[model samples]
Target: MRYLMFRLAHISDPHLGPLPEATAWQLANKRIFGYVNWRRNRKGVLTTDTLDNLITDMQEQHPDHLAVTGDLVNLALPAEIANAKRWLTTLGSPEDVSVIPGNHDAYVPNARMKAEEAWRPFMSGDIAHSGPLTFPYLRVREKVAIIGVNSARATLPLLATGYFRKSQAKKLAKLLDECKEKGLFRVVMIHHPPLKRSTHWHKRLIGGSRFRKTLAKHGAELVLHGHTHLLTKDSTEGPNGRIPVICVPSASQGFGNSHKPAARFNLFDIDGEAGNWSCRLIERGYSSEDKLISELGNQMLSIPNG
Candidate 1:
């Protein structure tokens, strides 16, 4: 029997653009601050051209699935959300892409809801879900079980925090167990890092302890997130052992400064079976010298046997 490896591509914080025109009412709340910040700080840095090039290269790799961790829009404006749907479609079909909401997607009250309505196809599970979409949704592909948890929510000005409720914790625990029972490679995707102290206090995941507790109890093969817009590799306690948590830079960032890095994405090759699984992570992004995307490095991720 031939063992076919699954190629999964991970990209986050695209912040997809050409910021649509917004009315005064749309900018009245937290969006006002985001609008100003985008205009002054991010407008020049995050560009669709950069994302296009990066995605073009990613498509050349012919990944089996794509995981978008979020921040597909800048202001969460209606037009921006609609455009993001089109962008996702151009990137891949709904069956091949899975998305979770980011803080920016919920920049203001009900903004995340709008995103849900527009991007439901990409975010929904394989099974039919009644009413509104729920977090910790499950999508099993081949031998991999992809679980999506939404941590994004509307916040006050200057706040980019994420939240993981007890409700989600319960559902996630159940999902993790179900996946494990099936002998599947469980991969959890969340917008915010679940590891404590992984991000600053103001921009941290509020219920990270609860999230971590759930993982510690239930266990998972890997966790993927994107919010810091910087490459990060961290791990947390799991029932079996330390579970690897990974993050990538903003997918739309055109160039890197001393502080913020350039656009990048990860390609994960998942293979093996229960109790003896294997995964290799390949980092690909802009080469500062030529200002072109290329393979940066690769590593074999530690997979704790459950």
Candidate 2:
């Protein structure tokens, strides 16, 4: 660990939209379905007011770094992608923020390519290495090695699943080992949860078993993800002990009804050294009745000493 203390803020599944008006041509493909879903359900559920307020509060926290774990766009429309990039600029500069894509980011076949190009800066590592920007990409900030993995993929309509490729899994294991050698706090950021039971059959990660096996072989201090759009806290076996896997509700949602969750995000205050560290997770959100954003929970946790 290099820093005496570090503050990291995490938010996810913004699903940001008020979809840009489209021609019949634009909605010709699978987007036709997405358009209906957005207008009929998401339009009311994910409000810009809530998203703006959440972002305003997040900025006020002034965390050392911010991690947005994907679904930045809704329809993967050309305009939607452009708008999301602009929104990211408002959130923070590439130097202060990092992002990984969710399934929605790659909603259509060609959308993945566009997203990779549009969001490359946020996804790139500090030390530019060889090859295309690949999964298990590492950004070392102070003591934290924020590793980002790509799980987003274009799927058939009504299938919201993700896939963690075997090639990526192999690389991830090596990256985790590297972190252990450097004594950096390893935080794995993926759009989909690595746990098998994390999501429904239709939305689950396709190769989650392999991902978990990689973790069991290597190790990480923490795992943060979204996708499920619910507040989830569970544990998985690490080389040394149990590793905490946490998820927060969608960033743009209002306090949920039956179908959606409210807006929420997490601030992790991290400190201490390699093999001896302390991290306190502070969860904040705007509840259905709350007049303002406030802390919902706080818990002190320790990373297993390597």
Candidate 3:
């Protein structure tokens, strides 16, 4: 049997904006907070020119697939959702892209429903079965399986937490098992980190414990997420071994202090067999001073041939 190398470009938290035109009624709710933040501080930290440069750079790399872990829209406004859909078209065809929603994508209770409808093509599985979109959506790209989980949900004002529903949790384990049997490189992508302490208290994933349990039970090659908006590396247990969970900074983060790094994305060059994988991670980010996007970090991750 021959193994082929697969390159996946992972990006998160684009939070695309300029806050599309919306009615006052739309801004009367939770969106008000998001809109105010966007106008006051976020707008400065996140610039369209910076984001465009980052995307252009990623396109230059031309990975086999692009896995975006959500927050395409900040307020989940109807217009914002529409804007994100158009943005998705630019990312690539549904077959070349997979996406999951973030807390901002479901800023309001009903906003999640609207988001599902708008991003259905990108989140739906290859099998194509369903009236409504469902989580643990597995997109098989040749030698890789990109499984997207929906951690985005509506919450009270000031809360940015995500939730992995009991139902989604159950399906996630089974999805991992199926992927394992196929011997494909499984990359679990979500908006929130599945590990505890990976985020602020108010922004953590609600069912992280259960999510962790599922992963330890079934296992996956790698996990990618983006809710924290910073580059972080950590790991948790897996059935056969340890699973690497990486979080990259906002793809639109222009520049900032230690807390806020500039726009960045993760590129994984993967190959080899189960338990003996040779994966090279290249962390790429924008350089405002140089007006270019360049490699920021690199690591050789090997799954010891145990």
Candidate 4:
């Protein structure tokens, strides 16, 4: 069978709207800052309307798979988590979509566990043998091997950091080698950018150096992430070549506020066999000039390390 190109749509940080009502207890912790931030600044910027428009445009493109990087909810409230479940179904079936968590999804000490319980299906691997789903999970789609890594963890007030555990790095190395031996294109998904200098001090990916060390040793075709809420294109060193590391803008960002780009999603067209694959990135999102969502641009991505 001649395998055709696999089109994967990537979006992140929806920060889904109309945060659930919270009592004093719920807002007493770090959530208070997030809550205040949401009410004062984010309420106007992160809108479901923008997210709906972006998703509508993305669905119209007919991607073979969808990858959501994280932050589906703000404050990680039970109601917010439940609402995210409903919003996810509207995106596609669990089988058609793969998701990871972001810092906001783990806004509290117990929030990450709650998110895991709620968004289990979207975070599961291909083979279902599990008591608890683990990170660096594997999902195969035709010629591609999707590796979902967990870097999300609750942080102190005013910090939006993520952590990549050493254990996950070891497992990720093994998975990379296994996928390489199988002749599958490896795509690693995480909530924060793997590059060390990708974000500010407060929002950097903790253990990013270790994450890059693993990729340098084993190599991968592509890396997708979302946290800085900016449209970014950068590369990290791989064993044989450079691996493309990409991050998209928030899926629900409006036009006026913030220095970040307006809401956008990318469609990556991946093709070719293991050693000689090709990929292209087509970006579509809102334009601040006219506040209209349209095809922003496209670029041919670098191939995987040999």
Which 10-residue span in candidate 4 carries the lowest summed lDDT? 127-136
Clashing pairs in 4: none
Q: Per-residue lDDT of 146-223 in model 4, one digit per residue for the tens?
A: 999999998999999899988999999999999999999999999998896888999999999999999999999999
How many residue pairs clash in each candidate at the backbone level?
0, 0, 0, 0
Relative to the true structure, candidate 2 reaches a TM of 0.96
- Model 3: lDDT of residue 162: 90
**What global local distance difference test value does model 4 have?**
0.92
Task: Give the whole-model CA lDDT for all candidates, comma-separated.
Answer: 0.92, 0.88, 0.86, 0.92
In candidate 1, stretches whose alpha carbon ends up further than 4 angstroms from where it belongs are none
Model 2 lDDT-worst window of ten = 253-262
Evaluation by lDDT, superior candidate among 3 and 4: 4
TM-score of each: 0.98, 0.96, 0.96, 0.98
lDDT of 2: 0.88
Candidate 2 ranges beyond 4 A from true positions: 129-132
Tens-digit lDDT track of model 3 for 145-182: 89999998899999999988789989998888897888
Candidate 3's error at 71, in angstroms? 0.4
Candidate 4 error regions (>4 Å): none
Please give, for residues 107-182, the per-residue lDDT of candidate 1 as tens digits: 8899999999899999998896878999889999999999999999999899899999999999999999999999
1-306: candidate 2 lDDT, tens digit per residue:
156789999999998878889999988888898899888878878878999999999889889999999999998988989888889999888988999999999998989779878888899887776556778788999998999999999999889899998899989999999988988989999999879778889999999988888888898889999999899888788998878898989998874456665789999998988888789999988866754788888999756776
**Local error of candidate 4 at 83, Å?**
0.3
Error of 3 at 193 (Å): 1.5
